[model samples]
Target: MKSARMLPVLVLAWALALGNILTVGIAVHAESPAAAGSLAAPESFGSISNPDQRSAAFFTELGKVLTHPRCTNCHPATDRPRQGDLRRLHEPPVSRGPDGFGLATMQCSSCHQETNFDPGRMPGHPLWHLAPAEMAWEGKTISQICAQIKDPKRNGGRSLADLIEHIGSDTLVGWAWAPGFGRQPAPGTQKEAGALVEAWVKTGAACP
Candidate 1:
């Protein structure tokens, strides 16, 4: 009788031990950082021999970077530019004056200094100014922007070749990826984004 009672207790202890081992295994799997947040990583701009398909993929993925807060903030639809990740109305109610400069007395150069000044809460750039009306991306879908970009009338008369240099080496585009202090940088580094642009141009700059 004592042996029978001890057998039941032993089986229960074995089951508990198995459960603990399984729980620990699951925890180890969960805590591995590499396995977590895999979805948030940037997509690989893998090479493509097919000019058409490669061109399309490049622009499609590049769209994510271009349409981000940093690029779209200055390319707003209305005269008033938006700011921050929320894309809220520009503070202090500034407007894109006749020449894409600023309202009469409150020139963009007045507050947006040559360099970012965290003390003054100003985000700056060497040539800080609004994008031309043709480059406005606010209220535009990726498809629309892609189509417009391919049109000479809308793209500042630049050929596909021009886009490689325009996006890859342009100071303003580079600024989006490096805007300083408390500002969230754009999705990818400037060089990586520029390489993607170059690759897209080489593949013929297909619209997506």
Candidate 2:
């Protein structure tokens, strides 16, 4: 009789567990792409009336990728770039030399080969090197980075069109999406980021 009495309790427990599992599954499916680490289309910010505000909104979304470690590790505020998701000081001690490559003793290509080596856990690309010192973005506000990106001298003479091409289709920039096994990729794909740049320039390239 006691065993019979406990049977209902056991059934109730399993029913509750099944209900919770279904709820979680439904929630996951409801999540948006931007919520799942991809950029949203510029038109999604439809509530804003001003074109400049809408432009700034687009860049703000792009900022998610720009400020990410994949982009920042190479855009060090100082000469010495940092690494890892934690943005810790780079191991093996390296710095931006006169031409954005390392010194003769510690060239970037010395360890970072043409392709990432998951076995050794080193991220690489054929053209990996620091951005110019003037483009250093670590510790700067999004507004500051935006201003620098618009200036020809700071942006390496890139016209708005050139900026779109560089960020949109450049193979080196595309690497941020495929950074090695242990690293977190930037928020969205490079193509998406470039599209945002193009939209921003078309709408006045306003800064946030």
Candidate 3:
């Protein structure tokens, strides 16, 4: 009689445990990172026989990363930088100030430290500031941005060769790949992006 009574309790306990497992599984899936996409290798475009066409194609591949929210958020057309994957304007209404950093009373480093704070969902780097106004990429076409990048006046005075180092190895640029919590990283690895830049330069840096 006691075992008969315990049978119902045991079955209820099993059902509760199963429900908990299912809930956890669903929660984990929901919180997982979204597909951030990928970039084609530079060699993959070798099939294009024309150098100009090949260079343009290479840059077009690199454009996948350049045009992503990760790159565009900091390169806002307006003085106010954006945040989040949705590319929303930053809260608290901070401006780019005379420098790329925020106004005197509200510097970016004040909230963003040297590393990401997952608890607060804030991303950081040692040099956390917006790109210069002239270099803003937001709302620009790939070809327009391409033209701007090749211009010393608009590209922070970087030469085509300088861009390779900046994109491939700069820690600040690398941060896009490792942006903390709730963010989709830019497409592909930095090295791949760098290789595309190199290939594009070698092929005459043609724009799409």
User: Global CA lDDT of candidate 1, please?
Assistant: 0.77
User: Which 10-residue window of candidate 1 scores lowest in summed lDDT?
Assistant: 33-42
- Please report, in order, the local distance difference test score of every candidate based on alpha carbons: 0.77, 0.88, 0.91
Q: Report the candidate with higher lDDT, 1 versus 2.
A: 2
lDDT of 1 by residue, 1-208 (tens): 9999899899999999999999999999877532343212223645555678767787777777678888889888878898887788998998888878897898899888888887765788878888878878888888788887777788778887777777778887788777777666777666666777777777777777
The superposed Cα distance between candidate 1 and the true structure at residue 1, in angstroms, equals 40
Root-mean-square deviation of candidate 2: 4.0
Clashing residue pairs found in predicted model 1: none
**Prediction-by-prediction clash tally:** 0, 0, 0
**Residues forming the 10-long window of minimal summed lDDT in candidate 3:** 29-38
Q: Give RMSD to native, each candidate.
A: 8.3, 4.0, 5.4
Instruction: For residues 88-202, write the lDDT of model 3, one tens digit per residue.
Output: 9999789998889888999999998999998889998999999999999999999998999999999899999999999889999999999999888998989999999999988
Candidate 1: clashing residue pairs, number: 0
**Deviation from native of the Cα of residue 104 in model 3, angstroms:** 0.9
